[model samples]
Target: MVSAREEILNKLKKAIHPEPEMPDFDAPVYHAIDKSLGQAFKENLEAVNGSVYLCKSEEELVEKLKTVLQNVPEKEVVCSENELQELLTKNGIEHQDYQERQQAIEAGITSCEFLIAHTGSVMGSSALQGARQMLVYPPQHIVIAKKDQLVDYLHTAYDKIQEKYPDQLPSQITLITGPSRTADIEKTLVMGAHGPRELHVFLY
Candidate 1:
């Protein structure tokens, strides 16, 4: 004879049904909104306590970076993009390479895969050689991107990412909107609770 526990389990198993097949998902439909993509992005970013700057040229970008460094005066900087080194040097902002990236890095400069205007999000990955850590560990994250990188929505950004690495994808991808914030502990509400406190995007 079967034991009481075995008899109960057998009855329960018979009552269970087969799992259903997953359903297919189609592209989403989005409603229209006012304001151009860049404008929307800037507005949303600022609403979340992030900063945005538009630069007409590399010179202007570097100039603005110089001003930022001047304001901080004592924080260490880490540059993740090699293309930006010349600009940093031209502007006389002392910064080390990504090798120096750490929690102590007050600012991190890097490129991105795309900027989603709908949510004011900046997305990047190892495919772009963007250190996943630099996106979080630094107190300030300064992203340098071109206007051409803007996309209307997040899905479009993912599509672009797929096209970029068709053969093999990077191990890590990150999407960031504003300064990191959390109120998990006692609902005190803290910014940069887990990631960078400041997020500044320079779009040209």
Candidate 2:
């Protein structure tokens, strides 16, 4: 008998269109993975007009984020707890409770690290202390991932998870790609049907 995971994977395979070629799982897979991830993100975040930015370090990323916040009209910066607090205090951006702030942010914006990209899916995980709202509530989501984290495929992500936590996994693992969409109304396409309308990725 097939396990629940296998059954779900089979359904996912049928639901999502397959790529022309399987992603290479070799050491050089990072480049291809990055390209694929970037393409997927661009396709999902249409209003952003495929804008993507790459930064080398945390300092550089912070600087770019500040610029984005300043230059983009009415744009709010939504980040994880640590980054949020630092930015609020240092930059004097007034913020409410982290949870409430995240909820408001999720209604419009968010940021994360792309843990896995496969089948056009971007995976993100959160810790107990971390705010999951940053990942879930945003209408537009931006992710920052190191080039080294780009794996060839979903199976590679699973392997890494196993290796990293042999005994147990996290309570939740989110795999997102593209905008939340549906064609339920007589096959008419609708974006942001359930979740974020856009997904932006920044790789460095």
Candidate 3:
């Protein structure tokens, strides 16, 4: 009186195989990245439809920022950092403070805690100002980062965070690899599904 399901289970039990041994995770698994961390970050970021701009000087950075802002509407752009706001104002670039205009924000400029080169990711945390909204609310995200902020691996980034905040750590940490996208609906890729459709990283 063995039913079809019981017969199938008995046959599967007879053919079951032993579990394989797990490899040593402490040992280095990935190949060592030959290029500089900055280069690796740029290449990996670009591979996921993200844009990277390397600026050599402050003037160049401002100019590049201005160029990017030109495509976005004047009032639709939001910046929360006081330093970045000052820079934008100094350059005659019109932008609203995120607090001032939370509605219809087309773009947002933010600073990240660390940049992971191996995965081309930006590590942000609730501890950082404007990280929660400036990152996900806007249609376009512009991250200002320096070459020194680049880390070779995610673990190294975490170690650095621990060192930086010895007493209190951020409540939430976010790792953004590329533009927010998903292929959930019938496997059709859709950008800006859950967050910013465009991610731009300006590295100096």
Candidate 4:
């Protein structure tokens, strides 16, 4: 007796097509677009509702941050970087130092390892910044980066990461482009589904 499973398998066996040869992927991939790295990054990031600012100096970066941080609730920003912390304190902004128990954080302000210009991505690792949870737990994400940290391509950022951590990479490395978003429910777009909905990069 031919059971339902046997009948389905026999039908599938009767229908077959010639297999096509696999294409070669050994060659390096190439992209054709505007060559301006910073401009491209700003455009790409803004396209997804993320904000980007090019700061000429640390003072300017601090001022911009102070204004933007006002949007967060309780004017609370969490950060672990000592230098940045000092600057924020001097500016009279109230921010909680990175702590395990401080769960009601308005935003996590971190410095990223590299900013990929072509893809508008901010690459971060535990060694470059803080814990893995800091990247994921916050409702808002603010990345502070210098002009030197900008790279033209994503592979270039990976190369830099490898150079920095030659022996072993950090336990967690993340590549974030714009805000956390999805189009899963009834084809409607939503942000902050899995991570921070608001992503702001202060590039100086």
Kindly list the per-residue Cα lDDT of model 3 for residues 1-204, writing each as its tens digit: 999999999999999998988988899966688998888999999999999998898789889988888878899989999888887788888889988884689989988899999989999988777878888999999999888888999999999999988999998889999999999999999999999999999999
Q: Candidate 2, residues 1-204: lDDT per residue as tens digits?
A: 999999999999899976688666765544454466545444444333424555666667666655545533332445545654564457554444444453335323333434444354566666423436666566766565566666656778778766766788777767776667788999998877787666666656
* TM-score against truth, every candidate: 0.79, 0.58, 0.86, 0.81
- Candidate 1 per-residue lDDT, tens place, 1-204, comes to 999999999999999999987865664566554888888889878888989887888788878877776766343788867777777777777887767544366788888889988888999887665477678777888898999998888889989888988998778888998999999999898999899988999998
Candidate topping TM-score: 3
Give lDDT per model, in order. Answer: 0.82, 0.57, 0.90, 0.82
Question: Cα-based RMSD of the predictions, in order?
Answer: 7.9, 12.5, 4.3, 6.0
Candidate 1's TM-score reads 0.79
Q: In model 2, which runs have C-alpha deviations exceeding 4 angstroms?
A: 1-52, 56-76, 83-97, 100-103, 106-118, 128-131
Highest lDDT model number: 3
- Candidate 4, TM-score vs. the true structure? 0.81
**Poorly placed runs, candidate 4 (over 4 Å):** 1-28, 100-103
The lowest-lDDT stretch of 10 consecutive residues in candidate 2 is 102-111
Model 4 lDDT vs. the true structure? 0.82
Clashes of each: 0, 2, 0, 0
